[model samples]
Target: MATPTRPGNYREQAKTYDLTRGASPTIVRAVAEHLGEPRGRTLLDIAGGTGNYAQVFATRGFRVTVVDAQLAMLEHSARKLGGGHAVAGAAAHLPFSDGSFDCATLVHAVHLLQDPSPALREAHRVLREGPLVAVDPTRENAPLFVHEYFGLHPPDDARPSAEDIALLLRRAGFATVEHHPFVYTDTADGSLHALHTNALHLAGPAYLRNTSFWYGLDEEARRAGLDALARDLRSGRLEERVRAHYLEAAVRGHETVFAAWP
Candidate 1:
């Protein structure tokens, strides 16, 4: 199997990954609730960068295991969450016994994966009996604010659409497959400097943490786009609502929170 590589992948962008994360308490809570019952169940957070979801699970009484390909991400997650509670591995081949976890989570990062299909298969092997919640970008289903400014569409590659994901889940032998749409909304209460900084952070780190399309862009293109965005922001051409959308999935109006499970 071939592992994909990008110039400024998670290994390099782990530092700033969570600095401007769009997740708020509301969003996290929604995800937690979507996870079904969290009590006394073990979880496998595949490609669980920086333990954001794992941290939430741990507090909710679910014994959590965060697996990622980058040691740096797990290490940073440890520091931020105050414990070394993650493993370094690929989703295609998780290092665990059969039926090891009660549930598995493949968040937004799956689209960037080298082999998402095999990863879903691995999740099936590891889960004892519970739902595997796979979240992908809800961009296609919603209007985007980021698109208006940067035209930041994810490049054509291995990223799967919602329909494709459902097919994959069924192909992977998941039972009772279901799709749930969640919306995460965050509002900033008059913080100009913070808003400006967040605007740049949304583009990428290097131009990113996840959502590799920004990283995939040429350096010149990313720089030019950021400059124009800054100009609009400072000139009042860009409003606070626009900045809020950038902070999330680049859809200024709404962020698509698509979750699939079985």
Candidate 2:
């Protein structure tokens, strides 16, 4: 049988996924603020991975519906956040009525797609003429320590750019698309061992599996990259600054907004 087309390696990572990833209050607030008031609005969080992003809007009285291909992730979201409609579906084929939502969000989930067009179209189709906000890290602003360990370049085309995101939105028939560039910088806490743990959360399939970054490398490269990260952490050669470059979209005027991508 052929391997199924999926977004991320959540099935294996579900047990420790939340521990690997973080709770970025700044990111959550920014995404929610861009969408304006949420008193009675409805949102579709596509591939929402545990509903961390959805909770921000949901707490403010927005009716949030989360959909992901991973049942483990949906169960996790339910366990943590407690009250959102959870669905099992692919982003390319959302099991939603046309114009069913006031707006939609994709919290760093877009780049995980094997093809972006179909998901973008589906997002556009589900919203009631509102914005479909997305967020993700730009190659330029990625943390140097992590990127260098992985042997990635400054202009790596592996990840989508803000411009590419806007073009994708435009291609999906969004009339007005705006890119908002933001920077999220932080550092690891605790000893070298803690740094190693934190780094593992961001990379490697067995750990976080949040992104396909580690999966893109060869076995040799992957092992070497991770080893180097550990060595640098232990020896105190690394600065430990996580300079995450982020792009947030404000689409379709003052109504809807793009959420995020990983």
Estimated TM-score per prediction?
0.77, 0.77
Candidate 1: which stretches are off by over 4 Å?
1-3, 6-8, 80-84, 143-159, 187-211, 240-262
- Candidate 2 yields a Cα-based lDDT of 0.62
What overall lDDT, based on C-alpha atoms, would model 1 receive against the true structure?
0.62
Q: C-alpha displacement of 8 in model 1, angstroms? A: 5.3
Error of 2 at 156 (Å): 3.0
Worst 10 residues of 1 by lDDT: 187-196
Clash numbers, per candidate: 7, 14
Error of 2 at 208 (Å): 5.6
lDDT of each: 0.62, 0.62
lDDT (tens digit, per residue) of candidate 1 on 1-262: 8755743477766766665543356446546666787778998888888787677777788888888888888886576456546888888889888998888777666656656789888888898876787666543433444544455654544234566777777788786676654444442211111233344443333333244445666777766777777777577666664545445433322323334444
